[model samples]
Target: MGKRILVVDDEKLIVKGIRFSLEQEGMEVDCAYDGEEALMYAKENEYDLILLDVMLPKHDGFEVCQTIREYSDVPIIMLTAKGDDMDKILGLEYGADDYITKPFNILEVKARMKAIMRRMNKREQTKEEKTLVKGDMTIDRDSRRVFIAEKEMNLTAKEFDLLELLAANPNKVYSRENLLNLVWGYEYPGDARTVDVHIRRLREKIEKNPSEPKYVHTKWGVGYYFRG
Candidate 1:
């Protein structure tokens, strides 16, 4: 079966052009012209990737991306006409995997999509490993599930990725930048604070004492590591 993709844009010509290009590559493409319609289609269907435009009539891409992150971790690539760095930062802040400026080459779009999908496929394969145990914690990568002391723990997509990385390589220190790149993808334009937020949240969910973490430990001025 061909890969499925959703292309969201207000410009009919742009959407048509993208759809045609992807279709030539044997991809099944879906189109949404506005933010509300995009959200509706997203909720009702399962898509491998979402190409979303930043400017729209109803809700705008940022709002759509934020709302969707509340429910799904499907890869999203934000499309923008503005050349502002902050817009790119905000897209990553809202859980987007990547962003592209407007007037982009169609070939580049196809290339970027292929690269992101490859990373996602590699990640899914990594998740096929057998369960990992750390003290009272159990991480089942196949199902993307985590349990502490026999009780299942709820975690967002980013939170799970952060924990999985640290736990998989116990005692190995990872700087904020490292975590940001490995977990959120290299195209993400976030800072150290982003990693801090996810780490703090993960500790709260897994540690019996968030103030003094047992499994995840801060390495003074270096970074963070997981106790094996």
Candidate 2:
């Protein structure tokens, strides 16, 4: 079966354009015009990807993304009419997998969708082949599981992605922008604080002391590196 995608936008034209474009790429697409209906459809169906609009009746994309994160790890790409950086940053912080600005090229949108789907599919394909071990921590890429001293650690999807990226290349210092682009799969318009927050949260879960994180170390102004 082809991949299923959910398109949520209040604008009828936008929804139609996206549905048509994605369908041409051999994807099954569904649509909702508001956040309320979008949430309903999401609850009743399992989608491979969700294209969510930032401005919607009832809830808005940020809230919808946050609510969806409560129960699903399904990838989300937020759409916004505004070009404001804050809007994009908020969308990411709320768990959006990516964001598209208004007046976007349908081709670009399709390209981004294809890129994200390809990366996700590749991760699944190599799940069994990639495993990272550092000190007492073990990250199994196939199962998407992290363990500390054989005990499982609960990590958010984004947190796990960050750790995986860092661990995949141990001791390689990655700048904040690079991490955001590589792991987040989008250009983050906000300050580096988003990376800091996720890093802190990850440390609390994996480190014996969050203040003295051992696995993920900062290189002052350079960025972060995984100490394997």
Report the lDDT tens digits of candidate 2 across residue range 33-75: 9999999999999999999999899989898898897778788
Residue pairs with clashing backbones, model 1: none
How well does candidate 2 score on lDDT at residue 205? 91
Clash totals for all candidate models: 0, 1
lDDT of each: 0.88, 0.87
Candidate of highest lDDT: 1
